[model samples]
Target: MSSPQSRFYAARLAGTPVFDPIGESLGKIRDVVVLPQARAAARAVGFVVEVPGKKRVFLPATRVTSIMPGQVISSGVMNVRRFEKRSGEQLAIGDLLERTVTLLDGSGRATVQDVGLEQNRHHDWMVTKLYLRRIRSGSGLSKLVSRGQTLTVDQSGVKGLFGTDTEQSAALLLASYQDLKPADLADIVQELDAKRRIELAEELPDDRLADVLEELPEDTRVEVLTGLDSSRAADVLDEMDPDDAADLVQELPEQVAEQLLGLMEPEEAEDVRRLMAYDEYTAGGMMTTEPLITAPETPVAHCLAMISREEFSPSLAATVHVCRSPLETPTGKLLGIVHFQHLLRERPDRPVGEILDADRHTVEPNMPLSGVTREMATYNLVSIPVVDEDGRLLGAVTVDDVLDHVLPDDWREQDEPPATTGQIDLSEIARGIHDGDTGSEPAGTAASTTTRREGGRG
Candidate 1:
């Protein structure tokens, strides 16, 4: 089998199609796959495609005949059954997806939706187990309410629900919500070498794997992908937010970046290209491609519905925002911003306009640093929107971004401030030690390293 070139996963692949070696249709590419390793690059190897009317299937890198502008060609010879129970890395989606435990009643059961995680985003769901209850409402009004006897048991008991593992003792402490934080799980997953990441990811369900991966760091993320192989990594990145996907590509070496770029859909890759073209410091820089965009006439409820579907990142939860359409002339016009906390404080059903701060402050493209710095200081803004002359919003200037320019990171001072000119302080030596800043101490004479007592000995 010929190797897929190393450059295969240089950019994120979204909306790319998948095919069997004989050119039979399979699914749309969802994520690229890589084979994990320890330190060396994770080999770019395969793809996970969301097949229509069928379960998502994994396509091996070796089977790929060629990756072109719009499609992936492969020989339909790879077996996928082995990947079912594999997990590429240790990730939290397991706790999020489902877990088996013995309920307080002592009957073994599997949790359906983690009510714990829902109420407390940081909840360690393993403690609270919500089971599936079959709806048996047919006869009488009383029938709707169970006498609390008919329990819906999963075809398999608790262990069966989790597939391979047996139920733990009722006394075993479930992982605490605090301990199961994504940041914690991400750190743990990153600790695994590339090989372990691929192995764990392969074992994990493709959909679940995609969710957990969104939290990992760039280098570790690439490791996971490289381990899975280029093709699979490509598909996974496609499903990620465009900004995150661009962040990942920019971190890779140029050679690798170009290779992966070829495997992705043209439009998605182009979006990533535009994002990468900016400096990571300026307003054109650090700006995200994943802005919440809306047409000027878009109904408030309609726009909110789209935002609720996890289209925007949950990590950026409270800051969900919206933008204006391109045809409206002002390129990056601001529709409005919503802090979900404030949104929730009001009834969810209210139109977004009812709560928008119409008079919120905004900045423009050519605004000078002196004005911007003062604006930031006065308003105490965490992020200030940067707009063009027509009130078209372009990008937001985050505090860190502003600092990056005000204080260039690489050129920061250590202990002393940068010298004004290269001129030395000659006056100090000429004036003698007695006249120096150390006023209390006696001045030292040159001959004795410190003249015995001003002039007693020389």
Candidate 2:
């Protein structure tokens, strides 16, 4: 990074946009991955850059060409696969900051406020400074009058800040990542090693963990769920959608699944059991029991309000299932559906029944996955209501559910194989290309286009 200051703090680097070689926007920096060394400064390995779709991928420090104000420029070649935390690597924001450490000067203990990294003469980035806030102790008037001293110290001057055994609190880490989407949060949790994963999981509330479990790979979520106490695991399952809960329950041993189901509320457990009765590839299996549903006489405003809930997925929110009398699923006979668009266009005082979409297509609960996909595709619907023999709405199968089942089972595991370099010296090739470009450039223009990797540690 080309900053007037010799060092950069991790907090300031967060959310900084990163661009490719040709100045095309790549992504924004999320976290710096570091390998904490026992004696020397921690070496920065790469950055976790959140690309489009909230997919975080690794950008090696070696590829960084220039670090200008507000953004970073890359060499244009970065692995697009999801960033997984290696065994020895730690996230500067996720793992280090807000941790407790002791000062070697015998002053007192302090909480890490920030980490500072600087490029050495060899152009290798290393964590050499720590911004700290001294921990204060006292009570009543004394505590009110005292304030923690915030200061910067050399990395070598502190102890207990590195290694797996270091005491760290998940509170600050969770707060920093609170804005992350469930998918993004799941990615970070999935990449954490077993111990850290469980530690983080323990800190997350049941509802949040439920959302994360829905996004995580099957094996990882199962491991996390099982890692929790039985009561908490049951509560987490209760928070998950019935279909997702059923799928997770089915993955567990029958005995364990039965125990958890028995522990859940009777209503929620029944819903899951009903879903588990269906074949894994059937519409009944993939449908969510919590889609937006309302009585035929419900006001357009009420239907719109129901779909506006933050808990509802986009597909579920796109349409409202209008049914008779009982609003809950397996709702009384399916009347029809009102598209969100129609609801918006209609007067708020109008009933949803008056705005129902024509040419409705509904699928039977036992309908095969292929048949459901075909019907949804034929109707160009984001969600198709699933009904029973009596035409009562059981649930709705959404586009996301269909895609999830259709994709390969390993699609969630996004770690790609490491890149391979042949015997040819890649550095030599980079030098030759840069030399040619420099020769062709006019005046100082070459400096702006030059790759930072040239004429540095290789």
Candidate 3:
């Protein structure tokens, strides 16, 4: 009801931490839930907050006490139910960005860059400002170098924002979310309806989509992949880790899976095919074929540089597999491995082979998931190497891979209520918010859907 700032831009508000009155962390503001009006500004009813465990729930706007630079203060009476879009509710970042609108003075149309929300005299928040960028035409060198005029205008200065004929795309939305981690971006894609999800996925670069696909649930990954043409789908698959790509391929129909494999480049497809040969529960299936690898003769300095790459996940970079020539997986004999710590403590000029961890354990490809788990636990290692019967390195299985297999199939979905914070009921609090004596208010509801579903901020 009270505020540190009278207005806040939706994009800047996103990912801002939310805190209880006592200064304890609740979660983060993921998005604003707004209801559009025919001739009035859209009313913001609540927010989609991503709480602990990546679970998203609704936070009524009336309960927020202040919007500061890096955080939001709340009354802490949250509705722990998974947030869902009602019949007419629209997500400010998910559904509104990139909407084409006509200028009031008959000026050229522009796309919605961002929207600003502020509380009215009645303490009800509404979208009252818009950031617009003029639409530009043509492509090539000129298009890349030229700039479009941008404006900061009152919401009433633009039309067609909520019209059926308005052209809306995912271009600007994706740009606004460009800084989000792949996992965070995947959360947003999962919450969108099937149509919008595909639209956003199609607009992402192959490499970016590949990273996002690896974080998404199996069904959603498959759905997005199937939405693309075979050529593009294969390209995305190539960009993903072989193990993840194989897992996704297994979820597809046999014929469709084979077709996609054929469309992929021979080298990339070969890795996926090899991974698919083993049972899904075996170490072979869980290990990534693209682990950080180096030849025994490679300098420790070089191995350290390889592990430092941004592309490698922390688990994968924990140790470097040292093999004979043909440093790639399935290389000559698995000589040994050098942990990053070892590489760091030794002289930079030393060869990695001199610093191998003699006590490290290796697992056979056929080893079951249980065996892999025990191997990692017993050795106190972040990852274990998988070697062929002939003593050649096949790949390395990380702790994350084992957890993925051991956890419940639907672990990613946030269907249950959050840990209890208070005894208050959200419905009662919501009712008190709108019943106040406010002049000429637009009618709307904060009621969520009956069927529980997975969702997150966009």
Taken over the whole model, the C-alpha lDDT of each candidate is 0.48, 0.82, 0.82
lDDT of candidate 2 over 352-375, digit per residue (tens): 888778888988988877778767
Instruction: Tell me how far the alpha carbon of residue 256 in candidate 1 is from the true structure, in angstroms, after superposition.
Output: 1.5
Off by over 4 Å in 3: 1-30, 37-41, 49-57, 65-73, 79-82, 101-110, 113-122, 126-160, 163-167, 415-458
Query: Once model 1 is optimally superposed onto the true structure by TM-score, how far is the C-alpha of residue 314 displaced, in angstroms?
Result: 5.8
Model 1: worst 10 consecutive residues (lDDT sum): 449-458
How would you order the candidates by lDDT, starting with the best?
Answer: 3, 2, 1
Q: After superposing candidate 1 on the true structure, give the runs of residues whose Cα lies further than 4 Å from its correct spot.
A: 1-181, 204-214, 314-324, 327-332, 335-356, 363-391, 395-458
Model 1 earns a TM-score of 0.41
lDDT of 3 by residue, 243-288 (tens): 9999999999999999999999999999999999999989999999
Q: Put down candidate 1 lDDT per residue, 1-458, tens digits, no spaces.
A: 44333233222344577677666776666444433334432233445555553333455544566666567676655443212223442112222233344444454343432211111232111112234433233468656564233343322233333333532221211222123434334544554456546666655444445555656655676777667667766666666655556767887878878877777777667766865776543454555445455554545555556658754444333344456557222345576666555655665456665566554667764565444555655665556666666777665555544443454232221212333354422233223322433222323322212211111111
TM-score for all models, in order of appearance: 0.41, 0.81, 0.77
- The clash count for each model shown is 62, 1, 0
